[model samples]
Target chain A: MTTMDHLAEQTKLERLLQVDEGSLGFVAEQEVQATRAFRQQLSEFYYQRHQDAFHRLAGLSKLLPISASAKLAMNLLGPVLAAGIACELPKDRAAKLAGRLPTDFLAKLSLYLEPSRAGAIIAAVDEDHIVEVARHLIAQQEFITLASFVTVISESTLRRIIQQVGNDGLSLLKVGFYVEEKTALNNVVTLLSEQQRRALFLAADEHSLWPAVLSLLPYLNDTLQGEMSNLAAEGEEQARDKLVRAVAQQGDWYPLLLSWTRMSQENLESSIRLPALHEEALLRECMAQLEKHNLQQALPNFTELLTEEQQALLA
Target chain B: MSSPIETLRQEGLPEQALAYLTALPEEQQQTLAQQVLSTMQKKDERVEKALSRALDVVPAPLRRTVRKMLFS
Candidate 1:
């Protein structure tokens, strides 16, 4: 908006007009930055708008009597949206209203609400209602939605809910792959039974959810982070791309590198056995990425994974 | 399997271009990233040409750069 800002941008544009690959790269970079910034601003604008809408809905929920609200909700809003509206109401009032609602309605509704938004109601309502909701959500295989409450809801509540839901690893696997929140995903994984983690890796590979799971790597405990080498070392292309690319992008490769190093010599040997791992161009590119990121601390792990010829490329 | 942003994310810049947008909160950043990625997937080129023409007051090279940056 300022003259100086305009002039500076104008100068950059002139320089970017050179039309060579480097100039194209610069223009592309600047364009990407501008686009991202615009999108981010739009995202904030819309989020605030939605929050305002929800606040208004909460106010309306307070005005309507329970029977009236339920009828209007059932006929007009549908159960999940009605429950979403109810979630924003005062906890004690929401609890009373929840008690009167059909169990199936409440049960199905949990699948759609953010656990954080529903936290107060989950805590205020009787245990039976909460348990039934969790049961239905888990039974329906809405593991990601169910996992939303993992960090927000009380441990006692989570324990009771999962206990009734059964000990199968499917919930853990589904939650691990599908949950995007960094801390939340890390928590769920760290809490997993060992068997559950294995089941998770297998499910991730089977379903190609490994990319989502890879996003959680940086946030996990160091020991648990080391465990991810096996996930990365999976032979399939989807897993391989997610693995190599994630390591390339992260600031700290120590956890991942160390995981590879800790692999039994045989495991380490077999890691390069994957056809994709053998490609000189990709391996060099991965090495190039590590160098670009300037993570020299990861050298030892890199050294361990590559052949002597490959190690020389880092120089 | 490859997308421009993913390529940019992997090798071009560790700090995502989108990550710099508007300097919003983390939650909004996630939503923005998803929205931008979805929009980018649709690949609208006419918008780029329009933007380029709007900037035609600048030199030809600059005009081309604007169009290429936006659509290519």
Candidate 2:
């Protein structure tokens, strides 16, 4: 599994166990899907152990008036129990009760609600309410919660939230890092305007988020990856060195070389000429990674950019 | 030999998840399983404590009904 996958799974486990971040670092070497499966079971077990309580609280929605149920959820059940009961309630009824509650309460409840179990209710809630809750989550820097909803919320709702979340490239990158579904992430990238997309590159630079930027590159479709790479190529020479150095240090050359294969010749040359690329050790590591990934076919032009001395190292 | 996989299996961990845990080295499996066991216990205890505190504010007549509905 990729580093981002490990990070995403670790984040989910932290929430499931209510432990501090990095507490589950021991599982970092496990397969990401296996870790995800393990988390799913633990989450289900937690809810299952309390199913009777959740179901009883869900029963209140039927027994009490909608207004009273909403009040009871806020004042009596509190967010955690309210979220558990929300999962047990019928989708329409849950949406109705949610509508009657405050956005702040909904935002707090969102932290406890399992997106998988509450997907239907999330879809049923008003777009405006979801947007408002998203705003609250953004203010709280709850990107993990926000990212979990990416799978369930409609494309249009996500678009609106992205617009509201504009210019904060670090926020977008952080949320995107935790997003598990590549297609969903692609949609998010597609929704971004050219200006918004440019801001992301700048944000990565400003925050020194190159590792995340590199991790995200391979997941985007070819056209967008090439576009983003060409944009990075347009940056000052110092920025180019930073990008190349990050890839060399991380030892993930496939994404960078793949981007090289797609770049306009002018941009590719600009990228490969960075002094960082000329270092013999970095070049050797890059060639090894390229061969490991079997990407030599894509980089004939890239090879031509290197001087004979560097070319000899590859030989 | 006693193993983490066996301990987790006894706790009724789902088979699919247990398969993943079983793949780890014995030492790591032991550590991860212990963490899982402790997390479950901690979450259960925390919820029980929070519920008890939440119930303290309920009116006397309704508290009995709420307790029966949930804990019973």
Candidate 3:
């Protein structure tokens, strides 16, 4: 590599290593100085909860009542970490243990297991049990748990589970937020039909889900943006205001404008085709707002795009 | 012909074009982006300098220009 290119690569690697080390040190510091409330959260992960789960499971290893061999194994281990001890089990044995456990218990345990290992166990689970566990997780709004398990699921099963929970707006959005897989966001968006997507805003405003809606909006493709804009344009006053305010607050116009650029020609023609926009009085008011916001410079050619009658309103 | 921006609207959101311009790293945004603003005039150094002057004169937010340029 060229000396300059190598140096750039070296610097980038150094920056990445620094970030990793800094975060590790920060976590260590936090642990050392963790406060009372943090201790409460940490209490939830007591090694004993896991040890209890393992002890309870080990005591039931035989098909019949607690067997002598199983009892001895549980007695000898003294204290096994509950989280991933199951991974050391043969696949058949792990699957059998998972099959016998209550699904909610399995779901809770799944959250603490390594994702790849969890995925392996989940693959052995029956769809009926999987569905029940997923339903429970969704109801509990366990997005982190949900996200963890998605990494291991087959796509078709994932789609099935997603479709089942698709309409629970806020919970679905939370899972969308927590997903670790990079394409998981867009994949979720793609699963929604256009009508289902458009309906989110009406629900957003009514349910005060607008902030989440806004956050997720930019992640969706352009057509959805236009669809949303058109829906907003047709919506109530506060809805339109919310749209304007979001567009106003954006640091970059690219996401919204890019959506505009990809909008159907029919939709583009229609944004200005509003009879209201053409009304001189409304035009004047909007122009005044635009000017008040110091946007007059951006529309240098705006007057030319207007009818002479509309242009007169600028005066 | 309508302005390139208007034509772009007809073509549908210039998601790909903006992604290319911004070099956005997100897989979904970049993967789906396509050049929707193909009719844009090639950069003219003269126009660039003139607009640069105009920008200095009015000092408007580029966002306003982008807003009007795309949606007006």
User: Among these predicted structures, which one has the highest TM-score?
Assistant: 2
Docking level of model 2: acceptable
The estimated TM-scores of all candidates read 0.54, 0.89, 0.48
- Which tens-of-lDDT digit does each residue in A1-315 have in candidate 1? 112112223233222121222321222233433643443343333233344344544555565578765554555555544554665678888788878777778766665455546677777888777777777777787665566567666666766765564446456555554443447655565555556566656665566444445445656766667665664464455555555544444433433445554455555555543444455766766555456656546445555766666555444
Q: Score the docking of each candidate (DockQ).
A: 0.03, 0.45, 0.01
Q: Output the TM-score of candidate 3.
A: 0.48
Docking quality tier of candidate 3?
incorrect
Candidate 3 lDDT over A179-257, as tens digits, reads: 5453556666666655556555566666654544555556656665556556544556556455434443432333333
Better of 1 and 2 by TM-score: 2
Cα error, candidate 1, residue A1 (Å):
30
Ranking by TM-score: 2, 1, 3
Model 2, global lDDT: 0.81
- The DockQ ranking, best first, is 2, 1, 3
Backbone clash pairs for candidate 3 read A261-B12, A261-B14, A262-B12, A262-B13, A262-B14, A263-B12, A263-B13, A265-B10, B16-B33, B16-B34
Candidate 1: residue B23 lDDT (0-100): 54
Q: How close is candidate 1 to the true structure, as a TM-score?
A: 0.54
Q: Flag regions of model 1 displaced more than 4 Å.
A: A1-77, A111-116, A139-144, A159-174, A177-180, A228-275, A308-315, B1-72
Higher-lDDT candidate among 2 and 3?
A: 2
